[model samples]
Target: MSASQAAEVVRMGVLGHVPPMSYRNAQGEFVGYSVDMARAVCQDLGWTCQWVPTSLATVADELKQGQLDVAAMSLLSTPERRSHMLFARPYYTSISAWVARPGVALEAPGTRVAVVQGSAQARFAQSRQWTLVEVKTHTELAQQLAQGRVDGLLAPMMTVVGLMAAQPLQSLQLQVQPRRDPELTGAASFGISPMRPELKPLIDGALERLERNGVYDKINSRYLPFKVN
Candidate 1:
């Protein structure tokens, strides 16, 4: 491809602001740390970014079908993902936790935990044997909890915290356990189809540069307190 062709702008898919990571505002404009980083990398590559926005429920299929060159949406690099895509080294790390109503807490064996399908938390719920209620959107999960349809939710801590901040209610409470096993509680890395092996190296290099230049922290700080090591 010629330079112009290479810079012709690539399409990226986003799970549209489910919190702390990526989301769309009332104007239908995208804003989030992940989107910024993706844009920065595309800029560095002399390429333009065309966002192919969709719900988190269908992002995986979108990537698989070549509808997107990369997923700007935050996704874990699991064996299942590896079977289909390449991934950059992790640019961020966060722990998983459960959210419940203010007076209700999660208990084992009988708990009904709502998790977003295809998310790491879904697998965690299965492993723990929690009766799973899979949902397409975080908003749906939160609504379920509010309506007492589910007992709790499982997701990255900062995301749940951001959700509670954005929609304050006495019924929502996030419980975090920092010491859980990595497989069950920790996630990092972004998913990219292996077709663009070249893009993988480029993205990895760009991430390194972002970290060195403190760009990552700047974007991340907008939503979460990354400084709290």
Candidate 2:
């Protein structure tokens, strides 16, 4: 592709794995709710969607540095993130939760809690002074909890549910404690890099059009049990 043509391609980043939200299929292709939404948006805009695999720990930095044009993973728009990247119109609402093996007290001081590094869940765990066991991906998050390496896992409610339904974790007996933290519960949006501020309106329009045309609902029904927006 020519340099200018390539420059016009959207470098959209997808989180390594977050189940129904974002994850790779058996065929090693990214296929999930967020991915579908991003693809639809790209189609609407007539732009090529160049999927860039990323993790929650580094998405913000990648956007700030112009390494990514947009992050397709659903992200909570917090003050800290707003300082570095622009957020598009919210597409869904999310809440945080804690999961653990039966009889474990998550409220206890210094309880070891596994979280995806640089995520809102991590920040909430740190705020509660929990001993943080940071991981980079959803698979690691599940493994850390299933192996008993951590006393508990803190993450978004949907993510925890999706993890429990998937392999290497479906057989494990765990208790979920859904709690809404001000910082972690709110509207979730796609992250737009500051380097491409001009794409904001174009993406927002695409999302709106998708929602209006019923494409968004179809994608949501394919993945989630209920509506998120």
Candidate 3:
């Protein structure tokens, strides 16, 4: 943008959370794959992005309350959310895994599982009829696993693995069960407000271009060590 264009730029809030996807760096700047992706789209659309760093609790509310224009938290495209939000083409995909203390049966009767509230894992846990310990974020999930408060946790594989690698749990012998995803949420994407419907195609076009130009691949490689799909 030119000096004069910067003066008239449309400043919009873009929300994000989590590591590798969106989080504050050592310099306290919001930096991650999702952040870069959002910035790319914003630049392409000739807008100035102000990142709204949000937690699991306030992310949805920030969008609903009109405080944010885009939620770049790798949100899964759901039919229910589609009723009011416009989801861009998926920028990432994820799979679920069952992490548990040793000797606990994952699919057994009366198994206790911790899951993020309102996440796909929560829905999966509900379908299995297990006791649920609903948490608001991945940190809480990792804490629950470390504390032995739940027999197991259902969560995204990479996030949980990263947590385990960073935090060494003691006296809490652990086991991990990798389950074949049963259509349990895949292909997460950025969410745009339905109020700004016109921006969807422009954002989508930028994403398509980014993918074609290897920008998406470069961004993905910087964060994720393996191919999600």
Model number with the top lDDT? 2
Task: Give the higher-TM-score candidate: 1 or 3.
Answer: 1
The lDDT values for all models are 0.71, 0.88, 0.70
| Model 1, residue 37: C-alpha shift (Å) | 1.5
For candidate 2, lDDT tens digit of each residue in 1-229? Answer: 2445434789999975888889889999999999999999887777889999998889999999999999998899887789879999888899988888899998899999999998998878888867999998977988998888999898988798789898777898888888786988999999999999988998898899898999989999999899887
List the candidate numbers ranked by lDDT, top first.
2, 1, 3
Highest TM-score against the true fold, candidate: 2
Give the clashing residue pairs of candidate 3, or none. Answer: none
Clashing pairs for model 2 are none
Give the better candidate number (1 or 2) by lDDT. Answer: 2
List of clashing residue pairs for candidate 1: 17-22, 17-23
> Clashes in each model (backbone N, CA, C under 3 Å)?
2, 0, 0
Tell me the tens digit of each residue's lDDT in model 1 across 86-144: 77767666677767755555656878988888877787677885789998887677777
lDDT (tens digit, per residue) of candidate 3 on 53-159:
56544555555555666777677665655664678788877677888877888878778888888666776788776999998777678788777788888877766
Question: Which of the predicted structures, 2 or 3, would earn the higher lDDT when compared with the native?
Answer: 2
Model 1, runs deviating above 4 Å: 1-6, 102-107, 168-179
